[model samples]
Target: MENQAFQIGKASLLTKQSMGEPKQLTSSIVILVLATNIVYISNMLNLVTYLHDRMHADIASSSTMVTNFVGATCAFALLGGFLSDSYISRFKTMLIFGPIEFLGLASLALQAHLPSLQPPKCDTVNEWNSCKKMSNLDASILYLSLYTVALGEGCLRSSMASFGGDQFDENDPIESQQKSSFFNWYTFDKSLGGLLGLIFIVRIENNKGWDYGFGVSALVILFGLVSVASSFSFYRIQRPRGSPLTRLLQVIVAAFKKRKLSLPENTDDLHQLDIKEETFGMEVLSHASGLEFLDKAAISHGSTGAWSLSTVSQVEETKIIIRMLPIFLSSLSCYICNPLLVIFTVQQGNTMNTKLGKIHISPTSLVIIPLTFQIIFLVLYDSLFTPFARKFIGYRTGITQLQRISVGIISMSLGMCVAALVERKRKRVA
Candidate 1:
C-alpha cells in the first residue's frame, strides 16, 4: 500500500514536471554521480592490474579485456537513453539500473575475496610465461560481473546529467546561470570522488586486497542507491519524451512509402504543424535544403496520414541529427586514441616510483594527479573564466558545444605528443 502510494505520487510529480530543490539535488543526482565515479573509476583504473596479478592473465589479455569492458559500458549508454526516451521515464531508468550496478559490484567483491573463485596467482611476473592463465570459469565470472556493471553504469550515466540539468529551469535567467554552474560543480564533485577513489581506494586494494577495495566500492554504491530512493519525492520525474529512434524510423518509412510521389517546389509545401495552435514550447525547425529525399516524408498525400506521413518539424529534426553524424564519427578518433594512451601510461607508471615517505602509492592512484588538476580547472573555468569570457564570446558557458568538441580533439592530439616525449625521457632516465 505504501509502495502503491509512493508510485502514485511519483506519477503525479512526473505529470507536474516539478523542479527539484537544491537539497533534493544534493541527496540524489550529486550523490549518484559522485558515488558512481568513485566506484567505477577505482575499479576500472586498476582492472588490468587485477587481471594480471590476481587472475594470472597475460598483459595483452588483461589490456584487451579492460578495453572491451570500457567499450561495452559506453555502448550500453545508447540502449539506456533509448529506453528512457521511449518507454520508461529517466528517473525510473536510474532506479532500475542502479540496483543492477550494485549487484555487479557485490558479485565482484565476492569473486575477489574467495580464492576458490579465482585462478592461481603467479608468485613472480616472470612465472606468467609458464602459467596456465586464468581458468575459463573464473574468466567467465569476471566478464559477467564487469559487463553487468557496465550496463548499469552506462544506463545510469545516460540519464544522470540530463536528470540533474532538468532540476533548474532555463526560463529564469538566474536558474539558467545556475544550470550552467550546476554541471560544472557536478563534474567537480564527481572528480573529487574519483580523486579519493584513486588516492584512497587504490591504496586499499594495493595494501590490503582487491576484496577489501571492491567491498568498500559496493557499500558506497549501496549508499548511493539508498540516497536516490530516499530522495524520491524530491525528484522531478520527467515524462518519457518520444524516442528519437522511433521518429527517425517514422521519417524513413514515410520517405520510402512516398518515394514514387514528386516533391512540392515551395519549402512551405512541406507538411508542418501550425506553431501557435499545435506546438507549445517545441522549436519548429526550419526545412533545411540538404536531405531532400527526407522531404518526401513530410509530403501531405491524401486527406489522412499514418506512418507514411510526417511534419516538416519532424523531418527537419531527423535531418539535423543525420548532419551531426560526421562530427560524431570524427570525435571517435579521440576516444580510440586516448584510451590506448591511458592504458599504456598506467602500465608504464607501475614501473615508476610510487612511494611518498611511508605511504606506498598504487601506480593506478597516479591518476589523481590529473584528476586534481581537473577539479581545480573546472572551478576556475566556471567561477573565473566563463563569466570573464562571456563578456567577449557573447554566448552562454563561454562557447558552443561544437567549439568545445573541437578544442577537446586538439587537446587529445597535444596530449599524445606530450606523452610520447615524456615516455622517452623516462626511458632515458631509467
Candidate 2:
C-alpha cells in the first residue's frame, strides 16, 4: 500500500511539472509581441509625418497633429494605469485595448487618401479661420480615432510591463535571472521591429503611397495581435494592488474623528483594525476596510473608521500622480525630437540630395540610421558598460536605476544636439 501511494504521488508531481513549461513559454511570447507594437507605431509616426509633408501641410499644422496625438496619449495613459491597477487583469486589459489600437490604425489608413473622411487639408493660411465652415464630424472622427488608439496603448503599456515582471517567481533565483534576460532581449526585439518599420514601411510610403504605408502598419499590428492571442492560454492572471483612493479617504475621516474626539493623547482606549500598505491595496486592504467602514457607517452614520480609508486613499492618489509625472516628462522630451528626425531626413532626401548630387534617397531611409545606432548603443550599454560598471562600481556602491537613467538622458540630449547641428548644415547647403 505504501509503495502504491508513492508511485501515485510521483505521477501527479510529474504531470504538474510537464504542464507548466508550455504556459510559461506562451506568456513570454505574448509579452514579446506586445512590445513589438511600440516600434511599429513609432516607425509609423515617421511615415505619417513624411506623408503630411508630401500632402503640403504647413510646418505648424504638421507639428500640431503629432503634438495633439501625443497629448491625447498622455491623457489616456493615466486613465489606463488606474484601470489596470484596479478592475481589469493585465491580460484582459490587453485583449480589450489591443483591438482599439487596431481600429485606430485602420481609420488612419482608410482616411489617408479620402480627404472627406478627414479634417480639411492644413495647407491654407489661417486654416483655423475657416474652421467654423467645416463640419465637426470629420475632425471629431479623427480625434476620436486617435484617442481610441491612445486609450488602448495607455492601458496596455504599463500593465504589460508589470505583467512581464510578474511572470518570474522572485523566490526562484534561476527564474529571476531569466526575467532580467527577458527584459534585455525584449527591448532588443522592440528596436528590431522599429528597424523593420523604418526600412520597409518608409520605403513603401516613398514608393507606393501614404495610404499603403499606413495600411502596412495596420497589418503589422494585426499580426502582433494574432501572435499575442495565440499565447493567451499561457498567461497567469495577477490581481491589482490596493485602492489608494479608498485608503486616502479613510485617512481623511480618521483625521476628522481624531480632531473631533479630542480624546486623551495616546488613547489606548480605542481599538480598531489598522490597515497596512500592501501590493494589491485595492484588492486586499480597500476591500476589507471599505466593507468595515460601510458596516460602521450603516450603524453609526458617522466617521465609522472611514477616516483612515480617506487618508490612505488620498496618499495613494498623490503617489500615483507623482509616479506618472516622470513618464510624461520623458515621453514629452522624446517626442519633441521624434518628428524633427523625420523632417531632417526629408530635407536630406530633397535639397541635401540635390546639392550632393547623390543617388535617390528617401527621407524614410534615413530613419534606419538612428534605429541602427540605437540597437548598437543598447547592446553596448548592456554588455560592455553595464558589466564594467558592475565590476567597478557594483563592488563599491552597486548599479542603480537613477544612475542609468541620468546617463541615458544626458546621452540623448547630446545626440539631439548633434542632430540639430547636422540639420543646420543640411539647411545651409539647401
Candidate 3:
C-alpha cells in the first residue's frame, strides 16, 4: 500500500511538469500573436487610403488622423501593462480584450459592407472639387471602430509579451536562456505576420473590396481567440505581483518623507529582504550607487512599517527604471519614419508606373518591398553578420545590446535620408 501511494504521487508530479513546458505554451501564444498581427497590420496599412478614398477626407486631415490613431494605440500598452501587473493576471487580460478586438473589427467590416454607411462614389479625377463630405453618423462610426481596436490592441501587446515570458521557469538556467530565444522568435513571428498582411490582405482590399478585406481581419482575430482558449490548461499563469507603480510611488514618497534622515555607513544596515542562496533563490541585487537620495528610504525607522521603510531591491528597481528613461525616449524617434514612409510611398505609387507584367499593383502594396528586405536582413544579421562580428571582436555575445541599438538608429537615419532623396527626385520629375 505504501509503495502504490508513492507511485501515484510521482506520476502526478510528472504530469504537472510536462504540462508547463515552454513548447506547449509557446506554440499557442505564437499562433495567437501571428493571427492578431495579421488582422492589425492589414487594417493599418490601408487606413490612410480608407479615410481618403472611402470617407472623402483631404490629404492633411487623413494623415493627421492616422498619426493620432497610431500614437494612441501605442500609448495604451502602458495602461495594459499596469493593469496586468496590478489588478488582473496577464491571461485574464488577453482573454477579456480579445473579444473586444473582434467586436471592433466586425463593426468596421459591417460598415464597409453596408451601402448606407458609406458616402456616394465621387469622380475623384474629374469632379474632385464636388465630392460629398462624410456625414456625422459615418464619421462617428469610423472613429468609434478605430479607437476600439486601438484600446484592444493596447490591452494585448505588453501583456502578451510578459505573459509569454512567464511560461519559462527562470530559476532553471536552461529555461532562463531559452527566454531570449523565445523573444527572438516572437519578433520574427510578428514580422512574418505583418509581411503576409501587407502582401496578401492589402492586395485583396485593393482589388476585391474593403468589405472583404476587413471581413478577413475579423475572422482571423476570432480564430486567434479560439486558439488561445484551447491552450488554457497548458499555460503557466502568474499571479499579479502587486502594482509596480504603487511600489515605485512608495519608494518616492518614503524618500521624500524621510528627507532629513542621516545615511547609514554600512550597506548591511539597510533594510532588505532576508533572501538566501543568491544563485537559485530570490535575486539579491547589490546596492546601486548614484541614487544616494533614494537610498534613505531603505533606512529602518522605529517599527511603523508603512512609508518609513523599503527593501533595497525596491529602491534598486526604481533606480533602474529611471536610468532606462533616456533609452526609452530615444527609441520613440524610430516611429517618425512610419508616417513619412507610408503616406509618401502611397503618393509615389499613385504617380509612378506600378505595372509589373500583367498585374497592376497598389501603391500601398509597394511598402512590402522594404518589409521583405527587412526580413532578409534579419536572417543575414543572425546567420552571417553575428558570427563574423564574434570572430573579429572576441566577444562571446557578438555585440552588446547598446551597440546593436546604436546600429539600428544609424540604419534608420540612412533609410530616412534615402527616402528624402527619392522624394526630391520624384518632385523634380513632376
Candidate 4:
C-alpha cells in the first residue's frame, strides 16, 4: 500500500511537469508569428502601388515614402528591444504592442473603405498623367497609419523571438535541443507566412479591392492575439534585467571617471560582483582582450561603490557590444539592397509579361518567387548540404556563423550587380 501511494505521487509529479513543459508553446507562438508576418508583408508588398495608384503620389515621392516606412520599422525594432530589456516584460510588451498594430491595420482598412479619407480617384484614360497630389489631410492620415503599424512591428520583432525562447528551459538537455530546433522551424515558418502574403493576400488586394485586403489582415492579427492569449498559462515568463543601456552607460561613465588610474598587471585585481564566476555566475567567457581602457571601470581604487565601480561582467558586456558593431554594420549591405530591389522589381514587372500561363500575376506578387526559392534552399541546406559538408570538411559542423554571413554578403553584392546589368539591358532594348 505504501509503494502504491509512492507510485501515485510520482505519477502526479510527472503530470505537473508535463503540463508546464513547452510541448505546444512553439506551435502557438509560431501561429502568432505567422499571422503577424502575413499582415506586415501583405501590406508592404503592394505599398508602392497603393501610394502611386490610390494616393496619386509621383513615382519618386512614393518610392521615398516606402523606403522611409521600411527604415522606420527597422529602427523602431531597437526601441522595442530597449523597452523589453528595460521596463516591461516580453509578454506584456507583446500584449501592449500587438493591440497597437491591430488598431493601425483597422485604421488603414477604415481609410481605404471610406472614400472621403482617400484622394480623388485618378482618371486612368485621359487624366492619368495629370492626377492631383494627395491633400494634406489625406497624407497625414496615410502616414499616421503606416507609422503606427511600423511602431507595432518594431516592438513585435524585438520581443517575439526572445519571448518564444523563454518558453524552453536551457538546463534540460532535451528542452535545449528542442529550443535550437524551434529557432530553425520559426524562421521557416516566417518565410512561409511571407510567401503566402505575397501570393494570396497581394492577389486579393489587386484583383478584388484594397479595403478587403487590409480588412482581412486586421482580422488575421486579431486572431493571432487570441491565439497568443490562449497559451498564456503555458508560457514561462522571464523578468526584465535592469536596462542593458544603463549598464553600458554606467561602465562608460565609471571608466571615464577613472581615466588616470594605472593599469593592473593581474586580471584578478579587477573588482567583481562575484569573484568566483564571470558574467551572471556562469564561467563561460574569460576576460576578453582589446579595449584595455574599459577595464579601468572594474579597478578597485577605493570603496566608491556601484556608480564608480563595476563588475567584470558589466565591463565585458560593453566590450562585447563594441566588438560586434563591425559585424553588424557589415550585414547592413543586405538590407540596403532590399528596398532598391523592391522598387526596381516592381517597375520591371510593370513592363514585363507578368502573365503565367492563364493567370495574370501582379508585379507585387513577384516577391513570392524569391521567397519560394529561399524556402527550398533552406530545406536543401538542412537536409542534404549540411551533412555532406560536415563529412567532407571532417568537421562536426558545416560552416561557422561568420563564414555564412560573409557568403551572404557576397551573394547579395552579386545579385545587385546582376540586377544592374538587367536594368541596363532593358533600357537598351527600350
Candidate 5:
C-alpha cells in the first residue's frame, strides 16, 4: 500500500510538469512569431540601400533618415513602457499597438505611388530625370511614413517583451527555467525573420518595387497581430509594475532609510522585519545622515569617483564601461561593413555585370547569409555550446545576455575580417 501511494504521488508530480510545457510553449510561440515579424520589417536592408543607390542620397543622408525611425521607435518604447507599467495591461497594449505597424507599411506603399498620383510642379526637370532626382516632397513623405511605422512597432516591441515574461509563474522554479528557454527561442525566431527579410523579402521588393516590399511588411504585421490575439486565452494576466518614477522613489526611500530597514538575518527574522515599525530606527537614521555627510565630503574633495555612488555602484559601472568599450570600437567597423554588402551587390548588378562577367545579385540576399549564420550560432550556443562550457568549466550555468552578445560581437568581427580579405581578392583580380 505504501509503495502504491508513492507511485501515485510521483505520477501526479510528473503530470503537472508535463502540463506546464504546453502552456510555456504556446506563450513562447506567440512571442517568437511577433519577434520574427518585427525584425523582418525593421531591418529591411534592401529598402534602405534602394534609397541610397537609386535616389542619389549619400550614405550619411540615408543613414540619418533610417536613424530617425530608430529615434521615433525609442521614444514610443518609453511611452509604451510607462503605460504598460502604469495604466494598461500588457495584453491590451500589444493588441492596440501591433496594428499601427500595418499602417506604417501602408503609408510606405502610398509614398512609393505618390509621384504617379500627384503631378510634380517641376514637370520639365522631373519628367526628364528619374523620380530619384524629383522634388524633396516625395522623400519627406517616405521618411515620415517610416517614422510612423517605427513609433508603432517600438511600442509593440516593448509591450510584448514584458507580456511574454508575465506568462510564467516566477515563483515556480521549473516554470522560470522554461521561460528562460523561451527567450532563447524568441531571439532565434527574430533572427529568422531578419534573415528572411534580408534574403527573400528584400529581393522581392527590389525585383518588383518598393510597393511590393512594403506590402510584404503589411502581411507580416497582420500575421503578428493574429498570433498575439490567439494567445489571449493562454495568457495568465498580470498586473503592471507601475511607473519608473514610482519604482525610483521606492528605491531612493529604501536607500535613505537603510538604518530603519531591517534585513532577514534568518527566515524567522523575515516575518519580524515585515511588520511596520512605530518609529524610524535611530541606527538607520544615523546611516542616512552618514550617507549625506559622505556626499558632502566627497563633493568638497572634488573627486571624480566620490559623490557619485557607493563602492558597489562604482565597481559595477567600471565593469559595464569595460564591457562596452570593445562593443563601441566594433560598432564603427560594423557601420562600414553593413553598407558595403548592399553597395557592392547593387554596384555589381548595375556596373560590374555590364563590364565583367559578374552576375546580378540582390542586396538583401547578401544580408541573409550573415544573419543565417547568426541564428545558427545563437541556437548552437544556447542549446549546446553554453551547456558544454558550463559542464567543463563548472561555471554557473544560466542565461548570460552579456556573454551571448559578446559572442555575437566576436562573430561580427570575424565577418569583417573575411570581408576585408574578399575585398583584397577582388582588387587583385581587377
Candidate 6:
C-alpha cells in the first residue's frame, strides 16, 4: 500500500461540533492514565513475589521469570508502534490491546485463586523434595497468561502517550504551548497512579492475597478502557502514515541504488514532495546538513519508483535516525541491570524488621521512597534548575536531551552502587 503521508504529517481535524477539544481530550487521557498506570505499576512491582509465593518459583527463578516477562512486554511495543502507524489509528490500537490485557489479568486471577491451578505450597519445595514444584502444565498456563498480558500492555504503552499528544494542533500557538505542558501533566498523572499503586495496592496484596490484587488490576484496566471509549467521539485521531521503518529502509535502498550518481551543485535540485502531493498533507522536512552520502537517494534517477528514488525529507529522516543510534544503544546499559534492584529490595525487605507500630509494611511499598524523590526532582528541575542552568547553557528544556540522559545514567549507576553497599552490609550483619 502507498504511504498515507509520513508520520501524521497533517491531521484533518475530524470531530463532532462540540467534541475533540483539548479540554475533553485532556480529561479523558487523565482518567485513562490513572486507571492504566496504577495497576501496571502494582503488577510490575509485585510480579516476582507473586511468581515465587503463589506460583512456587524460587527467588532466582522468580526474578528471571519477571525480568523476561517485563522484557517481552517492552519488546511487543514494536508491534504497537508498527500497527498504530501502518494499519490502525492509535485510539483503535488502545481499544484492541486494552481488552487483551484485561483477559490476561483475569486469567492470572483465576489461576492464583484456584488451588488446582497452583503448585502444592510447602516448607521446602526443592530442598529435600518435600513437595513437588509447579507442574509443567501449570507453568505453561502461567507463561501463556503472562505473555498475553505483556502483548496487551506493550502495545498500549506505545500508543497512549502519543495519542494524547495528537490531540493538540501543533501549528496553533496556544495549543502548541499547551502541548508542551501536556507531557508534564502526563508524567504527573502517571506518577500519581504509580504512587497510589505502590502505597495502597501493594498493601492490599500483602494483607489480602495475590488473587485480590490481580482481580483489582483487571478491573482498573477495564475502567481505563471505558474512559477511553467515553470520549471516543472527542479524539482527533491520528491518520496512519505507513511504517516509518519502511520509509527508512526505502531511503537506504534508494541511496544504494543511486550510489554512482554525482552530488548536485545546489541542494534545491534534490526532490521533495511533488507539488500536487505537497498540497495534500505530506510532511515537508527540509534537507539537513551532514550524511551527504544518503542524499544520493534524492537525485533525479531514470525510474520514478519509490525504491529507485526517495524524497530529500525522507533521506533526512534516515540521517536523523542514524545520528541518534548511539543514544538508543547506550540506553540499554542504563536500564539492563537496574530492574534487578527491585527484586533484591523486595527480598531484603522481607528479611528486615518491617513493623511500624501496628502497621505491617509491604516490601514492594518501598517504591514510594523513590517515587516521592522523582516527583520532587521533577518539580525542582522545572522550577529551580531550569532557571539556574539557563544562565550557563541555554536551551528551552534548560539542557539538551543528551545531557539529561547522561545525568540519568550516572544517577542510576550511583543508586546501584549504594544498593550494593547496603546489601553487603546487611549480609555481614546477618
lDDT of 3 by residue, 1-430 (tens): 1111101111231233455568667888888889888878767767888888888888788888887777778888888888888788788889888888888888988998898998888875677689888899999999899888888887888788888897776656667656756776787778778888988789778788988888888888888879988887667666666666777888888888888999899988988877762212134777979988999889898644646777888888889888888987887678778777757677778899899999987777787787777778777766677668779986544677778778788889998888889889989998
For model 5, what is the C-alpha lDDT against the true structure? Answer: 0.55
User: RMSD in angstroms, candidate 3?
Assistant: 4.8
- Where's the lowest-lDDT run of ten residues in candidate 5? 1-10
Distance from true location, Cα of 27 in model 6, Å: 2.1
* CA lDDT scores, all candidates in order: 0.81, 0.56, 0.78, 0.79, 0.55, 0.80
By lDDT, highest first, what's the ranking? Answer: 1, 6, 4, 3, 2, 5
| CA-RMSD of model 5 | 9.6
- TM-scores of the candidates in the order shown: 0.88, 0.69, 0.89, 0.88, 0.65, 0.88
- Report the candidate with higher lDDT, 1 versus 5: 1
What TM-score would you give candidate 2 relative to the actual structure? Answer: 0.69
Q: Give the per-residue lDDT digits (tens) of candidate 1, residues 284-359.
A: 7888888899999988996336588888888988998899999989899887874664478689888798899998
Clash pairs of candidate 4? none
User: Judged by lDDT against the true structure, how good is candidate 1?
Assistant: 0.81
What are the per-residue Cα lDDT tens digits for candidate 6 across 59-98?
A: 8899888788888988999999999988988888999999
**RMSD, every candidate, angstroms:** 4.4, 8.1, 4.8, 5.3, 9.6, 4.1
Q: lDDT per residue, candidate 2, 1-430, as tens digits?
A: 1111101111231222333442365455544454445434454456345434444444556556656666666677667667766786666677778788778777767876687765455544345344323346655665666677677666666566666665555445556556655665566666666677666776776678767876777677677667767765454445655444545455445554444343323322233334555342232222222223222221222444544323333433444545667865875665577556645455455444433365654555556576778778778767777668768875321256556566667777998888779878876876
Backbone collision count in every prediction?
0, 35, 0, 0, 2, 0
For candidate 1, what is the TM-score? 0.88
